[model samples]
Target: MSGPSPAPAASDGITPLQQMVASCSGAILTSLFVTPLDVVKIRLQAQENPFPKGKSFVYCNGLMDHICVCENGNTKAWYKAPSHFNGTMDAFVKIVRHEGIKALWSGLPPTLVMAVPATVIYFTCYDQLCAVLRVRMGDWAQEAPLLAGAIARVGSSTMISPLELIRTKLQSQKQSYRELTDCIRAAVQSEGWLSLWRGLGPTLLRDVPFSAMYWYNYEKSKSWLCERYNTKEPTLAVAFISGAVSGSIASTVTLPFDVVKTRRQLELGELQAKNLSYQVSSSTFSVMSRIVAQGGFGGLFAGFLPRLIRVVPACAVMISTYEFGKAFFRKHNQERLRGPLQTRNT
Candidate 1:
């Protein structure tokens, strides 16, 4: 049999509600810090090279064309580069200079709405599932963090995918959305409630593998680091570094899925507007094929650099805050309940 099932952290008496709340709290705080990078990533992903004679979004065509037409840059295929954003710092500079600081937070509302609940569901389910898997698998269960993470993501993603779709729609828009509610209302009114889940297939494809790789890498890294340092608990530095490394690995592996998901969702919106059937771009394979046909392999990795930059810190903050939040809240809750109970007894 296995050595023993992993025990829940109960420094202050763990509860399901408390677990969910702590996860949500951590995600919300991280979201605020990461929202700007998120916007740049989304904008970069949504943009298409207009110079390429195809169905691309052609966002920077005018500017690029103006440059080429006027100054005549050496490389005619300079626009063939994967995405408009050169790097993280360049993305920030270009977005702020061109679109204004406010644009960097364009989809914050919908993202916040989704992220809290998504994190809550994901973390709670991950812990619960891990416990169950450990009981069944014994010693081998600890080696299966990827399985636990994938299972947990399924539950969380199914619940929150609609919100993810909405957030993507809002964020990837070339035009501004007044608010989250406006975007939701438009989706509902135009394409019925089903529109909210238009790209769930691709979301699952992206997220399931991403979560599996991320959680597995993180757990492995954390375990190694803790053992190397001979610590019972991971230090903040350890957690941050582990989380960042894991996030980067997972993100790079699953970036193509992310690109396909965004394209499918963006196309879904257009199809809905035109009242066309799903055949325009129905399947993930079809979308992938089209992307390859148009832009070659580079299309699959659009916005990778900015995504990497955003995800590393975002993942580090998320996991670190989650661990800290759980500890802090548990202690706080214990003291809060003790105070009330002690007064009543006195």
Candidate 2:
């Protein structure tokens, strides 16, 4: 036998209502986790200073930096663990209090639209890549899985990058995008069609390794959970715990890339400049070299702590919620189909 599943795994019999609530909570959680870093990354890309003074809504994460205490030995930025830890709850408060329920769904459309097809592509391509790897290396332990995940993620990221780019711009605004079409038009008219993928380099930079770890760790943990604990086969709690774990691991591997991509996309002239650099790769290298020379590596990972804080829990919540909601909806529909037949027979 495989094993017994856990105590809370039974779920007290999950209801559609609870699942739906959990899902909405989850999405908001991820967005909260990601946005502050999103702001910082974008600003960095735009070539602006990561931390500007004031309570501006655009990037209000001055908490990531240090207060410059008079320590004799040296200066090291302390991780504001408490502040970072509270990001999800804070997001919940902001949404419920300020904008109400509608705000919870703010990034939903784009997320749904972007994530689904990309997932399809990633899985399909990953399976194929793994099949090839199986032939070539027979599940060779070290770097093979990482390479496969990276390759698969690259294709998905390319397709999804445009919508993702628009979503970022849309969410950051006090007024969200008038519509997806309008967002597309505005991005193109101003920045050219290519601008939709402004931060693509960084995205792939983060995704490849992240995807590998996500799948590898998730599969291992889930199998273990199912085997060792009384995990509910299909319940919000399990998904939540699994997703949170997944997000946390993914965040660490992909954070640096997220930082770079944010900076690339945020910078206004970067898209056109990058396009121009295609004709001159050497020139592009020189420009990046100059930026590093000026700012040092810290410029690259600016606001990472805030981002890590925001994203890890948010990811856990959102993904878990989404999956559980989907399961609940499917179950509800099946029950509805059976109810009429039972009533008619009775």
Please give each candidate's TM-score: 0.70, 0.50
Model 1, 1-346: lDDT tens digits are 1112225443226677878877887787777777665555435544532322212231211000000110122233222223377766787887777766776665455446656777888988886776667667866876567888999988887887675555444433433556767868877999998877666687789989998999888888887887778775667787889899999999899999988876765565555434455667568898999999999999999979866876778889888777676667666878988998999999
Q: Over 4 Å off in model 2, which ranges?
A: 1-151, 162-199, 230-235, 269-295, 322-346
Which candidate achieves the best lDDT against the true structure? Answer: 1
Cα RMSD of all models vs. native, in order, equals 8.3, 10.9
Clashing pairs in 1: 2-138, 2-139
lDDT of 2 by residue, 118-236 (tens): 55466556545654554566436334445667787888789877766565544433234466568578768998888777657655666777788875565455546666676545355
Q: Top TM-score: which candidate number?
A: 1
| Local distance difference test values of all predictions, in order | 0.66, 0.50
Error of 1 at 23 (Å): 1.3
Can you tell me which runs of candidate 1 are displaced by over 4 Å?
A: 1-6, 9-12, 40-104, 163-197, 273-277, 330-346
**Position 139, candidate 1: lDDT:** 65
